[model samples]
Target: MKNVKLISLALSMLICFVVSAQERTITGTISDKSGQALPGVNVQIQKTKKSATTDFDGKYNIQAQKGDVILITFIGYQNQTKTIGDENIINVVLQEDNQSLQEVVVTTAMASKKRKATKSSTQMVQGKVAGVAISSGYVQYAPSQSIVVRDVVSLSPKNEPLYILDGVPVKSDQFAKINPNDIQDVKVLKDKDATSTYGSKASNGVVVIDTKNGIYKNLTEKELDAKLNIVHPAPTPNQEDYDAFVENAFESPKTAPLSTFSIDVDNASYTNIRRFINNGQAVPKDAVRVEEMVNFFKYNYPQPKDQHPFSINTELSDSPWNTKNQILRIGLQGKNIATENLPASNMVFLIDVSGSMEDDNKLPLLIQSMKILVNELRAKDNVAIVVYAGAAGLVLPPTSGDEKETINDALESLQAGGSTAGGAGIELAYKIAAENFIKDGNNRVILATDGDFNVGSSSNSDMEKLIEQKRKTGVFLTCLGYGMGNYKDSKMETLADKGNGNYAYIDNIQEANRFLGKEFKGSMFAIAKDVKIQIEFNPKQVQAYRLIGYENRKLRPEDFKNDAIDAGELGSNHTVTALYEIIPAGVESDYLNQQPDALKYTKVQETANNYNDELATIKFRYKKPDGDKSIEMVNVIPNKTVALNKASDDFKFSTAVAWFGLKLRDSKLISNKSTTDILKLAKQGLSRDSEGYKAEFIRLVESAKNVL
Candidate 1:
């Protein structure tokens, strides 16, 4: 009887063990906000303590009896407990928890608040942001100064920013064509940290433009919906050219022989004259430095009536990096079209000739560029030149717009030198402009340089304060960038934003024509200000995601209000684009697995409608610069990720370009990147290429590959 009982008990024990061994298995991954793996977390069965610690992947395995509780714990994190119900597998992510009293970093315009720091270095800090390259082709127009934020089309090999200009997703680069005089300011965001809100495309960067409007009169629907046409006259003879022609025409051969500055001729009172402008001295009564006067004067053109085409007219000269012995000329149908003999116009040609401006594409391009504007001068405009080297100095004085010879001599006389004293140069330029304050005419300083204000007065706050002070004088600023290496793009954009001006990057002649000639008001005249863009993602319509660019342009949840925060402007035909990469739910792969410990800690909640596939909705708020009211524009983008093969040429090209930038910066996020990919994308996207944009992309790709 005892033997029989033992046999039955052993059989019973074996049956129970067999039942316990039939448990189910589940799998997944664990990560932090930046997608890095989490490790060493504790994952366990809640009531029974039957548990497992997360392996290197924060993954775990456990056996629960029917219904069981699972609890997870980690340092500096809240403990999470979950019940194992009908679900076979569970995944999680533990969120960081910080007390309200804990010290943190808060970014303010003026200063940085660091609660803990061993030491600090003298690094330059500013509020300007960076842009993700859209395409090697558009790179020809990369850092395009016009910072309008609207382009919804996928990246083409030649597409610019994808901000919706006016209404559609036009290339925000259109803003680059407007005259700075028409704009009130511009702001840019360049890093993922600042622009994540706009998603993948913004991952490249984001630009905000501020335009100027008239008094508070609200327009009708027709007025609001009216198509805007931004047209600027050709860069014929602006004030600079006018002065040169005038000086040349009025040789005064009969007068006493003039003193040449450095000719085996003379270096006479030029330095003294330089010192005078530095000291804010009035123009000497008998001294005629035509270039100075042309740059320092202002012109008030009759605003075109609403019925006529809104036109823009201005000239910007991009000079050679080294001004010694260089000759380049651009001519057109006429000179500054001044009906009343070239009115007493005030002009500021803000030149950015920094060390970064050393390349042929930069300083050299600038020198040649200035010739275009010099060709478009009228006798009435007055000009001045304030240059920043290691420090600021007056390269030229306020001379008559009619003194063409004098102006040309002054322009041809400059040479590349030490560090960029952009800040000092700006300070002097504004002072000169303010001192010669024009009542109602146009007073603008046109800055030409690669956007790098590194050495002195390089703080964001300092620049902001200085610009505000200058703007109070009702004087405007415009930025013209030259070169590629070490381009301080974010910096140039920020100054333009604060100075109520426009920003542009000139890579070649066509760009100059498009900007200095084609779109003046959109670039210079501000039609709006404090433009705000908000993208709301419907959680029900999307899954896991990331914003690719515009890292630095991210706004705090609260910045959309209070009326004090600044934004970007819009130019006619401007297109801005924002792209997002989505990770679809239920599409499980190795990339989706999380460790058991992390899963226990993370309590992810997904609603039933999470597969809407709609990426995000865009909302825009803007105020007419000179007015008191606000306006808006909005759009929606569905969440769709096509095979890389089917993507738009613009999209593919942009992706390739972004890959190149990542390679340049050695970023780990982008992988398997090469010139081959760029070439491939360009080949795939080159449909109906315009102005050789697609061809250029191919050329650049070949060049990069060849050099490699």
Candidate 2:
């Protein structure tokens, strides 16, 4: 009986040991093959209810017993097992599954010579693979729809499918340069199972093309011959160019009593400058057009209430930079017509498909931008496409806007190659516009480019003359500048100015939506043409003054009366703002030139007793869309002074923008002001910012503070 009790006690101890071991805790970390943490991995103890999921850091703890089987599994990777031993901590490294890999589609064996029969390598991809989609058009990136494999997983602007040629990865454009005849086989890999091996870049999809000769081996005679006879043209590089405009200096109001300039509604400078600042580059001095920056954001100016297409508003306040000087704000608010009420549009998309436009920002962005504009077209609207690259050609004839798919298909058919022939492209675009002319309607040519014109009639003078002549056809122009590096702001401004059009720079899709989708009517239709502003400052109240910006837009005092002379065009609901820095008659300083030595040659007219009470007389002249004659309006502003803090939000916001421009140019005229000050002023003016553009401007100011 004693021996039986001892054996029973020993068995009880063994049972206790097993029970204790079964309830122990196991802890470890989980990661992928690259040693990166893998969150959400399942860590379970087999045959038990105890399991834990990896935290964000890939660390996990689970209840397990010694010798218990533990399972760790994650999507896109192979399941792993571990038998818990004496060790309390057991790390795991999961391997991706090979057999269950993302299903890759490959073309059933076709003879290389058979593939060679196609005009382009992209053609070889069509109808061969089950899941792969191949489209053809003059698209921004691919000549087709980026060779998508099923649905793409990228949220980037450049979601180009990756190509691996004969064990070497190549750019899509480079693949286009390779001879189609030299390719032996093609395979497309989709999803993470097949693309994980390529890391993050293969998320969009992958195309593996086996060439006749691998990089490891010398080309066979057949392959060499095929390459030498290939018809693919090599991509050429582009050079950058921009026009230089000297900054306007402060003018002596006593000698030059009048400031005359065409009112500019273009906002290209603001967006382009934003691009430069976001890229951590110093803004080019010439790129800082203050007028464009000021006009980029809309103000609270009242809409026109009478026969005039727009209303004129003026404000005077102490300058933010130099408290001693005063600022005069001139604003023009154009009439806002509902989209349904706007005239029918006749649009010709003058697109540049030159090799220089191969960059994602240049051609691909252009395609997406145009797509937005295309979606906004009405059923009666007409659309045409003219592309220039080496030479100009009509890709799509005039088509009804109601046929959106057909227009989109034509847009997708575009491809970038060869040299830029912008001039010939413009001529062709103008011809097509004239062929489909719509009288008393919105007849306009929307030219989109990086402004790299190389072939015939490429000079600014030539382009100006060509567009100037084309402007007589009653077909207005809208210059949409795209890309960077080689952007020709001067040329685009010149074209828009000479062609009676507006200019806008599109940096990304958000901007594209802003210009083409949200503000479609205003961007495409014009309310007034040949819009000019002439302000005659009274020497009695003002000693000296300078027109901010408009250096390239200045007109002779006599040009304002010449209806034949061309000026800027005002679009529907467009707002133009001009700021002037003036020195009061009593405020003495070095900038005044001492009243120009009392005007030795001519006798000065005696001022009327009430002239000092009138600060300035503002005159505006513009022609109706169909009228050749001009109508004039005049307004007299009394001498007024207001504190910077008491000025209207419109005045304050414009002052902030002007101050930011002066800071960017490092101007010696305006006193030094910090970006923080500008941000503060901008925030106060952020009322009624429903579109969020003003909010975006605030962010830009913050970004500029970091870089500047």
Candidate 3:
């Protein structure tokens, strides 16, 4: 009996030891004393190889046994240590290290070293440090002798720092071709320091090289290639896809007198075009949607004095590109509802976590964008998260918006992998949204993706059908596009258009702030849906008219009155603008190339109407957020025309934007207007620039000039 008891006791103790030795995930957030989250901070299990780095939100998770000591370290911050216990969460606030702040800290994959920020100090310690190798000579694939850094474990296949020659990103092979003698300065950033700035492209590291006089500055990729004689492989091609569209042609009042189309609130094309220009690349002609470019900026319009959801304004001026032609501007401003008065929201974040979204710009930037949106959420709002990879799944159930930490934790835990099953994810998200439907409230599914849907039901038509069917459930969609290469813009645009939603491309955090932060109500709450615009050009006053941009949004004249036909949705506080180039009656131009012959069989009757001074009759049809029937409004544009130089700032700015788009598209209709002309016109309209968006437009125009 004694011997049996001893064996039983020993086994019980062994079992207890095994339970204590098991590892569990330790997750926590690290912030500075001022409560700012510190990203790229290193957290490691002391005496063990297990470690993790805090993400953009300063959240980290690592596996370790209870009682293991974990050390947290970040440059310019005092190191911290904590012992793991029963609690799985351990939040830390680090204090600044004054001494460390004064010195330059060089971090490598293996460890970090600090030294005085003396001139050429980093160069002197380059090769002396372990895991860092610097060599000067003709390296592999390089034509000239250049300083190359090696020895660190590469996160990329090539395992070298991403080289930024001047301000443009270049491949290592191209970096090597530059003459070392012309080099001005070289700066290297490693680990989080590098990735934080450049995203996933700099996961291995980044080396920014500035040449004397910036010989390669502001050069487009094609220009750089030509200058350097860089031969690229023929098999590689840019995978980004955009729907091809033809520019709208001039229509004769004698034949097609009615100009009809849906109003588009989407601004994706403008930002996407801006991305190309900012990156020093030739803007793709097909990617330029003049309507989106004009509508991207908010215009000054009077508020509605009546019960209408939006107010309409009209202006007439001479066309900037062609002084002989006239420009007509129609503007609609949605009523701005205060955040407190806006209806409660039931939002499902339908995120794509596929392998294609693993890029730093796609996923990481997306997460940061969501965090900004979360900050805008009110206590009454609720959020759910559904992610799609190889398949669709809900990572977080419907949680109150007040529980921001929980929602953010869910966002932070997401990892990009597997093939895209966007269709399945959309179904699941709509189902969740329907189940948690807020009647008369804002119930929506916000999809953030690179739009690279490759799995089941991945085609553009497939997505359009899926979204069209799902939208009947009263659950709207908001498509937020991300990333560059392989980006499927057509798919995103189709989903948004079919689902009664708006689409915006988020290229950086600032854009996210603009769409989801500062303009939260306008981006999230719909005041009107199925908004259509139709104009009856006065045959007595106008001979020919052309609708600028919005080529794909054109609707049949009968479709405007058809309540069943779908159109664009106008969000609260949103503005929509449209321009028309008009040819006055009896005025002949090259655009009105071939006039239709007079009718042979029928006698045309001309009725004398009292509105001889009218340029056009504008009709607007829209449905309330929850209404089935459409409401119609009509406004008349008078025959008065203002000089382009005397037009309102908004009119001048919008015309300038339209002119820029025409220039970029190389539209034959536009008379030969140089970039200098566009710049001058843009500066004239650069008033009421509170957000600096107009100023940014001016800068983009300058950039376009330099690159084009």
Give the least accurate 10-residue stretch of model 2, judged by summed lDDT: 100-109
Cα lDDT of model 2 by residue, 473-589, tens digit: 999999999988778887898899899899999987677867887677777888999999999888888878899888878999999999999998888888889999998888866
Taking the tens digit of each residue's C-alpha lDDT, what string does model 1 give over 1-708? 999999999999999997787555544445555665455466777666354545444556567744667787763356777776677667777764333321213222344343321112101111121232222111112353432222343222222333422212234435344343433323334344323333334433444333344111133322323323444456443111101111111111112112111000001112212223333343232222222111111122234333211222212111111111111110011122323432355776656555555454665466556655554556766778777778887777776667766766565445555787777888889878877766655567888876567777776678777886776566767778665435554566557667666566665544454455433434443444555555555544333333333333345546655455555444322223333333343433232235234244444556666547554555555665444455655555555444556544445544444344334333443435566755676576566542243454455456544333
Worst 10 residues of 3 by lDDT: 137-146
Model 1, stretches more than 4 Å misplaced? 1-346, 352-365, 374-384, 389-409, 416-421, 432-443, 450-461, 468-476, 482-526, 589-614, 625-630, 638-649, 663-667, 671-674, 706-708
Choose 2 or 3, whichever is better by TM-score: 3
Model 2 has an lDDT value of 0.78
Cand. 1 Cα-lDDT: 0.46
Clashes of each: 162, 8, 1
Candidate 3's clash total is 1
Residue 413 miss distance in model 3 (angstroms): 1.5
> Local error of candidate 2 at 533, Å?
0.4
Among these predicted structures, which one has the highest lDDT? 3
- Could you give the candidate ranking by TM-score, starting with the highest? 3, 2, 1
**lDDT value, residue 267 of candidate 1:** 11
